[model samples]
Target: FRLAHISDVHLGPLPGVTYRELASKRVVGYVNWQRNRRRHMHDAVIDTIVADLKASQPDHLAVTGDLVNLALDGEIEMARHWLETLGSPDDVSVVP
Candidate 1:
């Protein structure tokens, strides 16, 4: 069977929040996103990857950890949507 394994998708379109929302480790993550992560993490890349994966038509897909960056509720929600776009929970094995 053709199994496609992917990890660290880091789905984008971060939620709107103020500085106070960023607490503890979130502060570091917010800073990183503002400084570097945002630039490198592109929706185009994800779209391309998804299109390629769809074209490949893997029998099963394995998605490892780190689907979100800071684990914020919004990030989690967005990731959920992203996963749905990939496939059903039965078709994709998510480790995150």
Candidate 2:
């Protein structure tokens, strides 16, 4: 089986609330800052991974934990969209 292994995608091309410019930076919170700052990097990572997967043309794809940084509901959708590029739901399987 031509299997593709991937992990820690953290898909995010969304506009997260930026806190760097805020005067009350202390109130922004760590999670919020990370979410916004990491969005671009995460997005690039996902794009590169997906492109690699497509070029490889694997019969199956596998992903480990941390698929999403914050585990947002929409993150699951983004992951689904990327996985769909492999084939279809019926063709893919996950351990957990």
**lDDT at 21 for candidate 2?**
29
What's the CA error at residue 32 for candidate 2, in Å? 8.1
Clashes of each: 0, 0
TM-score on alpha carbons, each prediction = 0.91, 0.58
lDDT at residue 22 of model 2 (Cα atoms): 33
Error of 2 at 89 (Å): 1.3
**Which prediction has the highest TM-score against the true structure?**
1
How many backbone clashes are present in model 1? 0
Task: Report residue 46 deviation for candidate 2 (angstroms).
Answer: 1.6
> In candidate 1, what are the lDDT values of residues 36-77, reduced to their tens digit?
878878788888988898789999999997887888889889
**Which ranges in model 2 have alpha carbons more than 4 Å from their true place?**
13-40
| TM-score of candidate 2 on Cα atoms, chains taken together | 0.58
